[model samples]
Every structure is written in C-alpha cells, then in structure tokens.
Target: MTASTLDAPSAGPADTTKVKRAAIASFLGSMLEYYDFYIYASASALVFGKVFFSKADPAMGTLLALATFGVAYIARPVGAVLLGHVGDRVGRKRVMLLTLVLMGMSTFLIGCLPTYAAVGVFAPALLVVLRVLQGISAAGEQSGANTLTLEHAPFGRRAFFTSWTLTGTQAGFILATVVFLAVAGLPDQTLLSWGWRVPFWCSLIVVALAYIVRRRIDEPEVFQAEQQTRQVAKLPVVELFRTHAADVSRVLLCAFIAVCSTVFSVFGLAFATSHEVGLSKTTMLLVAVSANVLALVTQPTLAVLADRIGRRPVFITGVLGCAVMIFVYFKAIMSGNVPLIFLAALVLIGFCYSAPNAVWPSFYAEMFDTRVRFSGIAIGTQIGFAAAGFAPTIAWTLIGNSRTNWLPVAAMVAVCCAISALSAATARETYRVPLTELGKRH
Candidate 1:
C-alpha cells in the first residue's frame, strides 16, 4: 500500500453529503459522456453506413461504419496513459474536467462533419479523428469517476455508490438508442440528410450539464490524504505496471466480459434489424431501451450484493451467466421471436451483465493502491476493452451480413465471456479487505 502523507491538513471523515455529491457527479458525468459515446455506437450500427460510407456496397458500408466505431478503442490505451497520469499526479477531478471538454468538443464536431458525397474520403477520415478523441476522453472518464466516488464512500457502500456510474451508462445508452430509433424512422431523405446528426449535436447540451455537476465536487479525501503524504506517484502508469502486473492482466481479461454488453446491445440491435432478420428497427430499439431500464434498476442491486458477499463471486457469476445466456439470446434473435428477444435481452444485458457492470468498478479499482489505482484500471481495462470496443465490428466480420446464421457469432461472444468469468474466478476477493490493505496479499 502507498504510505499516507502528514504534511497537509487532515481531511474529515467521509460524510453522507460528500458521498452523495461524489456519486451524483460521477453518475451525471458518465451519463453525459456515455450518451455522446452511445450515440456514435447507434450511428455506426444504423446511420454511419448510409451517410458516411455511401461509396461502399450496403453490407460493406455497414462494416466500415462499425470499423470506425471500433477504431476509437485503439486510442484508449494512449488516453489511459496520458489521462491516468493526470488523475494520479495532478488530481482525478481535473482530469475529469478535461475529459468532459474533450469528449463534448469531439462529439459536436462529428455532428458537423461533411458527408461522403460532399467531401469523399475526407469525411470518414475526419470522423475517425473525432472518434479517436472521443475514445481518449472516454478512456479516463469512468475509471476516474468511479475512483472518486469509491474513495469518498463509506467502506460498505463503495459498491453501492460506484454502481451508479454504470447505471448512468445504461441510462445514456437507453437515451441514445431511443433517440436514434425515432430519428431513423424519418422519411429516408430527411433521415439520411440531417436527421442523424441531431443526436451528436445534442451532445453539447449533455456535456455542458455534466460539467456543472462534475465541477462542483472536490477531490476525494483519500486522494487528498495521499497528496498530503506525497505518496502520489510521479508516474502512475509506470508504478501501476511495476507493482500490479498480475492485477492488470486480470483486469484486462475480466474486461472481455464487457463483450457481452457491447455485442448484445449494439451488434444485436443491428443484426435484428438488418434485412436478413426482417425485424423492425423500432422493435429492436424498444427492446434495447426496455432492457437498459431494467439494467439501471438491477445494476445497483447487484452492486449492493457485492458489498455484502464479495466482488469476485458477483462478477464471476455475472460473467458466467452472460456467457451462458448469449447463446440462447442470439438464438432468440435468429428465431425472430419478439417476446423471446425482449425477455432474453432483459435477462442477459439487464440482469446478467449488470453483475459485472455494477461490481467491476470497485473490483478493478481496488486491485491497486491509490498511488496507481487509476492507471492500473485505466490501462489494464482499456487494453481488454480494446477487444470489447471492437466487439461490434468483430461480430459484423464474423456474421458478414449473414444475420440468419448467428451460431459462430454467438460462439465468439461466449468464448470472450468465458475467459472473463475464469479470470474473475482467479482474482482475489476484495470486499472483505480493509481499505488500506485492499491490494496487498493477506
């Protein structure tokens, strides 16, 4: 564990007001950030092909769009290093502010970019640059937000509070998907022309609101205490690598479980609505929105369970459940069984995935001392998240416009989920450990 500093003034104990403020700050910030982020995912799946890649064949355009969406993941590790350094050395609060501004600017710019018809290849190139910026900004946002909230929270309430960050993500995703579903139904000419940009342009409003919420909160006492003690690492990225290599690897593998979340939410939505599947886009969108609502409710409940039992068990179970459920979920999608699809999405994404979604914030963050917790999580998880961010693209490539034959795609998702579950099983249980001794061996 990193040593505490005595040079600075002693901070007061964690209080309810501080805890609520921290959680709300993280939640609202993440909600906005993810709203911007999820809009792109929805666009990649539903709109980017028609608007940005009009030159390519229909199937190829959609694949290229999904590829652009995946390209952001490639920037995440870089962003993690840069922003993780800021969070650890400067302050989590400051890095968060910077991330918010970056994401907001990039997302808005994406809304304003020219289309393939107007600017040819330059349009997609500009889109890629903006997408990378969004990825970089997002890479640090959640980890920093979760860290701030966890450090501010009472011992037993860490999971309960940190869970809000993910709940916010679900809410953002729901909002984004619903908006896209509505806009997508416009007359083809209007929908293709300017309607799709509405969501991206609207991101400016969300970012501004998030800034107000996030800027009001102070750095958590735990980090402040570390700063006073001069235990803040000069290079958080390096320190994280040296001290918590195993934990980093474990987090990377565990993050693969997120493939379940991404593939089911984004790719499944696309697959169900594609001509092969013949389902209405609105039906798929409704299912996604409804399932996410259930997730918002279940995520906090699962997080509370982690606080009582342990993070590993909850995380492991969630991963396993997601892996097992995905096969049936895809089967339901292929069957064109509307009721089954709705129920499966709810059971899989809403309930099963929430186990890891709600708990992993604390589970991964607790794997390192405060000195490098941010980097350990940001880098490790982003590395694994690189795989997840590409999950839709991977599914696209595997399916290759073949929505009827989803067996192979389901297997790929299952494999990733299985790896995550096994990794979680191997990781140390941290719920019972004292805050100061969290990352160290007993």
Candidate 2:
C-alpha cells in the first residue's frame, strides 16, 4: 500500500499524437455534454415556463422551469457515485461513451415532449425526468474527460492540456446561447409552441460528432498501466473516501465556485430580462455569448500560466475576482446599459472566471492517484455542484416572487465564491507533483 509499491510502470515519453487526440476528444465530448446542458438552461430562462408550466402564474411558471433546471443536480451525485465507479473500475473510455449516449438520448426526448397545453401536468414532470438524466450524464463527463486528458498529457503541461475540457464548455455555452437567441427572436406563439425545441433536437448532431471523436480515444497509458498492475480499485468511491477524505472535502468546497457560473449564466439572464430590468433577451444572450467566446480564448492561456506558476494562485484569484465581479456584473445589469453589461460580463466571465474554469481539471485531478482520480473528482465535484445546480432557484426565491431584488442574490454568489477560495487555499500546491507521486501521503 506504500506509494512505491503501488506505483505502476512509467509511461515513458508521452505520445504527442495521442496527447493531441485526447485533448481534442475531451474537448468535443465536454462540448457535446454542455451543449445539451446549456440549451436546457437557455430554454428555462427563455421559454420552458410557458411551454411546460403555462397553467401557472408567469412568475410561478418561471420559477418552476428554473427549478426543473436545478433538478438535474439532484441526480448528479448519484450519477457520480455510479458512473465514477464505472470509470475507475471499468475504463475511462467506456464511461465516456455511455455518458455521451445517455445525455444525447435524454436531451432529444426533452425536445419531443408535449407542452403543458397538450399534456396538462405531465409536461413539466417529463421535463424534470429528462433533466435528471442530463444531470447524471454530465456528472461523469467533465471529470472523466479531465482525468483522461491529464493522464495523456506530457509532464509539465498537464494544466495546459486539461484546460481544453473546459474551453469546450465555453464553446458549448456559446453555441447554446446563439441557438436560443435565434429561437427567442421568434414570435411568442411559435417560440412557445415549437421554436424552443429546435435547440434540444440539435443535440443529436453534436452527440454524433462527439461519439465519433470519443470512440477513437484510447484510455490513458497511466490508467492502462494501473490496470496491468491490478491496482484499479474494486470500489473507487469507497477507497477514495477511506484514503483521501480530506482531499475530497477540499474539492467539494472548491467546486462550489461553480455557483458563480450558474448565477452569471442562469439567474442573471432571468434577472436582466425581468420587467424590473427590461433588458432584451437577445441582448443578454449576446452578452453571454460574447463573454464565453472570449473565455474560450482566455481559459487555455490562464491554464498555461497555472502550469508555470501553480493551480492554487490562479484558482484563488479567479474565485476572489468572481466574488467582487458578481456584484459588478449584476449592478451593470440593473443599470440597463448595454455597454456596461458587456464589459462587466467579459471581464468577470471571460477573464476572471476562466482562471479556475481552466485550472480545476488539473487542480482537482492531481489530488488523487490514478487509481481513484475519477471517483474522487466525480464525487466531490458533483456534491459541490448540487449547490450550483440550485443556485438560480435559490437566488430567485431569495429575491422573492417579484424577482426585483438583486442584492441578496449577489450576496449569495459572493459567499459561495468566498467559501470556494478559502477551501482552495487549504489545498497543498500540486502543480509540481510528479504523476506517480500524486496523492502519496508522507
């Protein structure tokens, strides 16, 4: 059980081709998954209430739609435990394939579901079920992809490569926003009846592309070497909790940094469009798309910086920056100035948020040995992400039914960022930890 005894054979010189392929695969897969995820988010913010909860008051319907969006997070922890087990015990590639298929199917079904006008109460209920499945699939996608890319990357550049997994997420968010913006521009009747489903159905195309890319990706050499040595854990979740409980705790809190994302992307969208603020849906979507497009460029740059400096500083800086910027971003929304909104969103999301978004793949994965990396990250992040999943709904409730109050919501996001930064500060800097030496207790 000692570190030396558990160490697998060195993987030798990293295969540059495989490293590039793995990064591409991880990026595409994450893009596919988040594409499915964010479309639902955009729909919830734009039209799901009218589509699925039309019988309720407008405010109540919107709240319900947003609530269904959060329902997926409820299933993520369960998926993390189950899918993470498969990733660790079976193989990363297999889990990737399974999660991609599951998400695609669920999102497609959501597109096909009847509206409340047609199905009465059944519409929202079915929406919730599909969202839960999407949540489960997403639970494993990023963590598994991150583990795969990191293990394939050349020594000293893991953060740079792993950053692609998140860059793909920004791409997905942009794609989702663009599609929804087009659909949102449709007349209200057509949009409510059918236009909204177009984005959900489009997931099938991305799913096919992701599957083609993912099928070609081999499991990382490190994981294969561990399997050869019979070092793969039989129950990775159990082993992870037993041996790396503190690390798990740290990842959990640090993962709460995601709250900033949900607030910015989801609640902020709702708040900006509310009658109190009256920003156009297209304008808000434009802001999101622009910021995310900028993030796609900035995230990898910051990740490269993390590889040179350390994950902790980059991550903490992002967290603290988000705490302050959440306030600024929302205040700009309240000001109803398009120029100010875009500027605040670009700086807060495109730059500051990109730091942790790019770094966490390596930062959290490096906290565990190869044997439990997937499960450790999956479980910890899913647990923390549950809060992120519900953040919009929580913010909505805190702002009261009118949705005019922005202060409490900003305060909530700031607190989440503060907790995440503090938790990350407690973690040992693992940027320089050798692959074989990671998670080895002294």
Candidate 3:
C-alpha cells in the first residue's frame, strides 16, 4: 500500500477518545520532562552556585552554575540523534517511555548529590554528568510527543491538539517556579542546605504518574500501519536531511526563538535578582510563575487560531511581538517596579511568547513526513537549543559590570527573534496540508 493509504485510519468516524487520550498523555509526559528541566534552571540561577561552586567569587560562581545549565544542551543533540532514531524506527511510544525514566532518574540523582563543600571537584563533575542525562532525555521528549499527538489528531485540528505538548511545558515551568518560589522564601541556610533539592526529589512522584498515563497510550494507528507496510526509513536522519534539508534548516533557525525562553526564564531570573538589580528572588520567581500560568491558558487558544488562520502568521506575530516585548520586560525588571514587572512579563511571555511556543509543534512537525518527523524535529531543535542552553552565560558576559544597561541582552533577544521570524516566513503554510502529504516533494 502507498504511504498515504497506510496512514489513513480505519474507515469510521474520528476516534475522539483516542485523540483526547493522546493529548493527555502528551501533556503529562511533557509536563514531567520540563518540570525536571526548569527546576535545574531555577536552582542554577538561585542556588547551584552556592551549593556546588562556592569556592569561586560570587559572580564567577553564578556564571559557572549557569554554564552547567548549558552543558545539557550539548548532550541534547547527541540524544536527539540517538533517541530520535528510536522514535522514528522502533516506536515513538518506546522513546517516550525511555526519555521519561532517564529524566526522572537523573533529576532525582541531582537532588541526592553531595555539595562542593563535601566532595569538592567531584561534586560539579557529578552534576555535569546528571545534567547531560537530563539533556538527552529532553531532546526526545517534546519531538516525540508532538509527532505522536499530531498523527493522532483529527484533520484541521492538528495545531490545537499538538499545542498541548507545549502547553504541558508551560505547566512544567509554572510548576517548577512555584516549587522554587517556596524554596526561595526559606531561610538562606535552609534553602542552600536542603530546600533546593526538594523539587528535584518531588520529580519522582510525577514521573511515576506520567509513566502510568503514557503506558496506557497506544502507538498511533498511522505509525503502526507505516510499520506494517514497511514504509519506515532505514535511517530516518539520512532520509530527513536528504529530502527535507530546507525544512530542517528552517526548523533550526526557528528553534533559535528558544533564546527568548531561556532569557526570560533563566538569565532574566538571575539578572533581576542579582544584588545590582535588587529585586527579590521570590518576586522574580512569581513573575515567571504567573506569566507561564497565563501562557497555559493562552497557548491553546492561539493554537486554535493558528488552525483557523495559518501557522506562519500566528508564529511570526509571536516572534516579532517577543522581539518588542523583551526590551519592555527587561526594562521593567531594571525599574524595580513590581507592578510593571508583572504587567510586562505577562504581555511578553504570557501572550507574545505563547504564540510561537504554541504553534511550533504542528508547524515544525508538518515539515517532515511521518517517517522522519521525529528525527527532523529533534535534531534541528536540539542543535538550535544548544545556544539557548548557554544564552544566560552569553548575556552574563555581555552585561559585565553594567547591570543597568540591559540593551545588550535585549539586542541579543531581538536578533534571535528576528532570525526566527524570517526563517519561519519562508516555510510553506501547512495548516491545510493532509497528514500524509506533509513533507512530500512537489
């Protein structure tokens, strides 16, 4: 049978039940994956320096801690290649299960690690190892989840269904910020001694619950039929690059938009709460939590709009909107006005940022046939995401001794957003493309 014929669901009404199940599974799995990720982000910004790099000067230690955060991105590309192969070849369901377990275990081990005071060099070394594992797992989580959800969704609603994968990420960020917000309010000694680890440890419970939900999800019927028909590529990465290089390049550039996320969620947190900026840690964390909470509401709505309109207009709008809003958000942080900070963050992250964040799942996945969709997205996004991993460190260096001058950081975000939007503008509008027709050469 042809690929399209294999991809068609049995002749019947759409299985709304399976679609909803896939959405929930994708959401919970993504939520757990990002919760593990963002907690490390929160700790790196607020506590990792004190816990694992206390020997360095305060500024140097914070930079080192943030650098460790980037270390995972290095591993992500590697994981993307390896796990993306599994998702594309073996099964998306298998890759999803494996990634979740790896992330949960690595995060839990991070909580159990000894501090620098106890283990000296061994402490940071171990932290880097665990971070690498987290990176690898994360590389596969979103792409696999997005591919699964998109394939399972009914025609014309792909954006809305797949958006839940990222919406779960917003939930994860909010959940992480809330946990850290509580820990940030603890006595300094208490926070440093044990509070920071609590969130990482709590990951175990969520991981268990996600595991249960994901286990119940059947492999998408399209994927199963593709397997039965032997349409799966022998090497998905090779097929992906050979057939869809431009699409992969576009996804890579579009992925740079993640710099906006790291800046807002990671570097911005450190910048605002630094001694020079004089904002409270809990307050900054709350800003992140509130903005992401709003995104949880706005993203799916925006995805529905993208389905009705087109991915390009919706995504480009968000990218350009973020370009403008980054300046306002950072300026508000520098202004020390708590009310202004919340307002700008809400606009920047909650609304503007949510646009691309919501749409990219379906947008990027649409660029590849199901045979290589997982690898295409994972490889492209992971490569671009490596920069996001280190963006906080880059911002730190750019703003040296000039905490008040937020221009460099804002400029960096503006440039990244501009490139992402320009690249996205070149993409074929896939809002109306059939599932099996995506990525087919003309």
Candidate 4:
C-alpha cells in the first residue's frame, strides 16, 4: 500500500492491529538499534580492555577502554542537530531509515576491524572512528522513534505507546549483555581473536529487519497534516532555539536524569567487578540483565499510571525514589551480598528509573510545536545524554585508590538526578494539551 493509503482511517474497529503493528515496528527497531549500540558499551567494559588495550596496565587500560566508549557521545550533539533538522524538514520516517542503516553499517565494520596486537595504536583509532558513527546514528534514533510513536498513538494512550520506545532500549541492553555473557566464556585466544566480533556482526541482521518494518509505516497523521499545511520549518534547529528555548532547557535538565541509568548499568558494573571491589563479572552481568528485564515490565506500567494521574507527580516520585535508592544500591553493592546486590540494582534501575523513563517521551514531545519537536528533543536530549556518555570516565576521575573517594562519584550522580527532578518540576503539565495546540504560547 502507498504511504497515503496507509494514512486512511480503518474501515472496521480502528484496526487496533495497525496501531499494534506500529508499536511493534517501533519497538523492534529500537531494540535492534540499541542492541548494536550497547554491545559496544558492554564489550568496552568487559572485552575491549583485554582485546584493544592489552599492553597497558589493567586499570589504565580499562580507563582508556571506557574513554573510547565516551568518544561517541562527542558526536551525539552534532548528529542530533544535523539529523534533527532533516527529520523536522523532510519527515520522521525517512530519517529513521537513515539512522538504522548508519548504525548497522558502523557496528558491522567494528566487528571486521583489526585488533591491537595486529595493528598497534591503529586498532583503537579505528574503533574510535566506528564508535563516533554509532553515536551519531543513535543520537536521532530514540527521539525519532519516540516522536513517531507518540504521534501515531490514540490520545490518552500516548505515554503508554511511547513507553515502548524506552522498553525497546531495555530489550537491546538485555540482548547485548546476554551475547557478551556467552562470548565471555570463550577461550581467551578465540575471544580476543574473533569471538568478540560476533555481537557486532549480528547487527546486520537486525538492521535489515528494522528497515523493512520502518518502510511499512505511513507518515503519522499529525506529521502528514503538518506537511500539507506547509508548516514544516525550513530551519527547525534555528526556530527551536528562538521559540522553544525554555522547553529545550527543560529537556536538557531532565536529560541529566540519565546519570542514574548509566551509572548503575555501566559505571556500577565496572566498579563492582574491578579489583577495587572484586565482585565476579558473572554476578555483575546478572545484576544488569535482571534489572533491565524488570525495567521492561515496569516502565510501561508506570507510563500507564502517568496517563491516569499526571506526568509531574509520577516523575517527581520517580526522581526522589531514585535519589534514595541509589544510595541503598551502592551500599548493597558494597556489602557484597549477591541477592541484596541484585535487589538493589533492580529497584534502582528497574523501578525508580522507570518512573522518569516512562514520563519523558510525552513530556518532551509535548513541550514543542510539531514543526520543531524533532530538533528540540534530539538536541536537548543529546546535550543531556552527553553526561551519560561520559559518565564512566568522569566517575573514574572522581574515584582513586581510596575507597572514600567514591563520594565524588556518588555526588555527581545525585546532582544530575536532582537537576532532572528540578527540570521536570518546571515543565508545564502537558497531559491535558491537545495534540494540535502543543507548544503554543500560553
């Protein structure tokens, strides 16, 4: 069927099936894209230190490995500006397809690159190049998907549907972690030589699948109407800053809440397993997988609650919960009880984090006019996400030989989470706004 045909209202029962199909398309696409992106993160922490930095001291090697992971974030804001403009000007569906191809190709190439032993410093140099491409591709993926899904959803259920976009992120992280677990057991020679490449290569399969699903989607009704009205901005980024600066700042501030997710998932994992604390890698990986699975369940449900209540209260409760639970989570990890560690990780990442996770899709999109929504969310979140991307390196700098030094690291996470809460507090309650009138002057 043509894109215009797919835009027609269904003859019977509103074809809940089409809406569902749309959700699955967004969900699977996000899962595949994030799986490719996060495999690098998981591998950087667990595998790259050994494979790409074999010659350096383990601590320094791990730091360098993590820094390489952060290098991708450097490109994120740039990608957000560029792709956000295209998405806003051209259409969301087109940019979604472009991001999938870019991410898939970059990830596949990473698998085929030479290792440190064979190419010396060039191995890491090539890795950094591919990572930057991955970052740029990712900068647009979630924002585009969230915007697309939210536009397509029935009113009152917008948050519920868009929550799946974040849910797909959880699925991707789970897939990446599971693959790493399997690869971790391989013989060191095989693992360093070729086994580690398997996860990156698998990205090709997912990328192909995402392309088919995305191609099948019509431009959302909201965007199509905007297009027909000739209201699409010629320069979305410029317009976003001029008219929506306050909302953009709100997004950037809320974006800082990402620290808890990154710290728990990446930094906490490394801190628990490294010689400083010496928790088993298997145990830490299990902790991550379990928490993500719980997040997949809770995020959508909490989003449903936000729809029933209001976005701000749900979001505030979540931020406050995360603030308290993170301290407990850290103490749990420090206590060295596996079950308690698992509980803490799951509660912090899976439950508390889900509160903010579920609310932000509607909250961010609601803050902008459709003309600049893509640019606003993409740029704002990318700027905010920058903290998440570099959080590990920053955490390391704050932490030294003294265990007491952890105060600085924990302080950073607390401060970021607090900012996110404050940002959410300042945002207008958008749950009642009509789709057409969103981002209008009060």
Top-lDDT candidate index? 3
Query: TM-score for every candidate vs. truth?
Result: 0.96, 0.97, 0.97, 0.95
Pairs that collide in candidate 3 are: none
Model 2 — which ten-residue stretch has the worst lDDT?
A: 1-10
Candidate 3 residues lying further than 4 Å off, grouped into runs, are 1-13
In order, the Cα lDDT scores of the candidates are 0.86, 0.90, 0.92, 0.86
Instruction: Answer with 3 or 4, whichever has the higher lDDT.
Output: 3
After superposition, candidate 4 runs with Cα above 4 Å error: 1-18, 403-405
Question: Candidate 4's error at 234, in angstroms?
Answer: 0.6
Question: Per-residue lDDT for 70-157 in model 2, tens only?
Answer: 9999999999999999999989999999999999999999999998899798888888888999999999999999998888777678
Task: Give per-residue CA lDDT, model 4, range 32-133, as digits (tens).
Answer: 999998889888887788888989988778889899988888899999999999999888888889999999999999999988999999999999999999
lDDT of 4 at 95: 88
Scored by lDDT, model 1 comes in at 0.86
What is the C-alpha local distance difference test score of candidate 2? 0.90
Best by TM-score: 3
User: How would you encode candidate 3's per-residue C-alpha lDDT over 408-440 as one tens digit per residue?
Assistant: 999999999999999999999989888888888
- Tens digits of per-residue lDDT, candidate 1, 1-442, equal 2333211223555446887998998888988899999989888888899889998988889889989988999999999999899998999999989999999999999999999999899999999999999999989999899888877777677899989988989988988887788798998899889999999899889899999988899887778878888888997877787888999999999999878878877788778888888888788888889989999899999999999999988888888888888988988988888999999989998889889999999999888888888888899888999998888888888875455778777898889988998888888877766566667755
User: Model 2 shows how many backbone clashes?
Assistant: 0
199, model 2: CA deviation in Å?
0.9
- The TM-score, computed over Cα atoms with residue i paired to residue i, of candidate 3 is 0.97
Q: In model 1, how many backbone clashes occur?
A: 1
